[model samples]
Target: MTYYVAREGSKLWKRVLGETKVELQLLGEKWKLLLVGVILQYIHGLAARGVHYLHRPGPILQDVGFILLPELGKERAYISETVFSFMFFSFVLWTFHPFIYQSKRFYTVLLWRRVLAFLVASQFLRIITFYSTQLPGPNYHCREGSKLARLPRPDNILEVLLLNFPRGVIYGCGDLIFSSHMIFTLVFVLTYQKYGSRRFIKQVAWLIAIIQSLLIIASRKHYTVDVVVAWYTVNLIVFFVDKKLPEMPDRSTGTSPPLLPISAKDKDSKSKEEQLKLLNGNSLDTSDRRPRTQVNGKHLEDSNPVNGDATMNGT
Candidate 1:
């Protein structure tokens, strides 16, 4: 019993040490990601504030999606918020999945770095898009009865920066054109599709993402175009960004799998197999055709086949 305990304890220590070494080696990369992430988030926050201040109440534009789908009531709008919150928290929980799944290659920090990269690019485009034109706000907060219908002009830069925080986004207006909520949802879904192991969970993730989009549209939290644009834009951003990023290392091999075309390897293997088969066939044919002598009504073969010399025995 003691021996078993000691063996297990040693294994645990070794794993911990190995993980530590890998993390320490990546310390510089981790810090760089952290710094860039913080800066990008701050810039996005400021941009959101600027767009919100530029918002003006106007007639809602004619939208095909609105004509097709009925706008959900205020209660349903709250439900949409709830659903988004669930997705956000679920993604946060999933970020730490490497701990639960025991994957050396897929660390929580690495996942965050990848997610941050995708979001930063997405948000950067969003800022440029929303800044191009101010659209009429569509949510209940943008309507007359709501207290937050029209945002008061900012007195100073500090107020503008502060207003872009979480509380501000809750009742804020004019950061449309592409949905931030959809960006997060799609990023999480795509990341899970690539890295997560369970088939059921992957399907469930996609379902949740689809449902989340519907809820955003139904609740009128965003214009239909916002949701529609997000659907394709986020998907494309993830696809392209994933292509640029380094592939994750496999735990067993401690190296990333090659992303080269599979047909090349297959062709090489096939050629080798063909050559081996031909050599084998030729050897069989040569052995059968080799000369044999009959001595006293019995067949005898050469002692050495390599030289191909024939020897005869006579009575």
Candidate 2:
């Protein structure tokens, strides 16, 4: 069966516009997709009577403050709840926006990859980790020697803010279960390597993920061991999937590139021109027919007279 899709003005527009829209849609879809996971986690927690089957080491310093200063204990709970609420709402918005609109075919692949990684694979891994490790609860055994322990002290306004409203609306038990960090970072790195040009941005983003994971561990939000395992697991899954999955062909070569309305002939012609321009180092100008000379002894003639010389010299 044939499918009808909207076309854009140019190949560049098609690739960029199509990809952008797809990304937005995929992002939105993730929130909705995660809703099921959220419900399941809550159900599981309720079934377990708010008792976690497995837990990682907690922050020793924070635990000490809780024991020594009861006031800090109250503050920590409040902060945790507040931060969690904020993170939850933000996640809802970030993950649900895509379901409101239809996405193009190119985006569908990306959307599926994310859904599989977070909604399926990551959750499975967490369950296995929980079962195998048989760790303590989310807040147990916090001591200086524990990998999950954090130095207990309000260092600055940031720590105080975190202490007061510990939980951001973005992350929660449900999110933790699936390790969104792993899913997102893996997808982002793979996607960037395959199609994106911003290598620096991708690298920076990966670094940020690593730092954030460390911070979470240091803060006693998650076990250092869990985070480490999650990093390797996610990277392995992404790498395998990326290797097995077929690379997307250059859509501009086909008759209908996504979001581009131009015919295949036009695309081919444009690409040919572009290739020629790159090779010759001269772009046709729309101004006077001045025979511009390149430093490398090449000559170019302007086709139209509206603008000026649009040629470049190799030298």
Best model number under TM-score: 1
Taking the tens digit of each residue's C-alpha lDDT, what string does model 2 give over 246-287?
554443245444543566999999999988977876556656
TM-score of model 1 relative to the true fold?
Answer: 0.72
Q: Please identify model 1 stretches exceeding 4 Å from their true place.
A: 1-25, 103-105, 252-315
Instruction: Score candidate 2 by lDDT.
Output: 0.46
Residue pairs of candidate 1 with colliding backbone atoms: none
Candidate 1 local lDDT, 1-315, one digit each (tens): 999999988877777676565555555557788779879988887788777767887777887767777888886678877887888898898765444445544766677888899999999999999999878888878755566766677677777767646778687788888998999899888988887777998998899888888888778778889999999999999999999998666553557653333568899998888789786543334457655655555545764433333343221
Candidate 1 accuracy as lDDT: 0.77
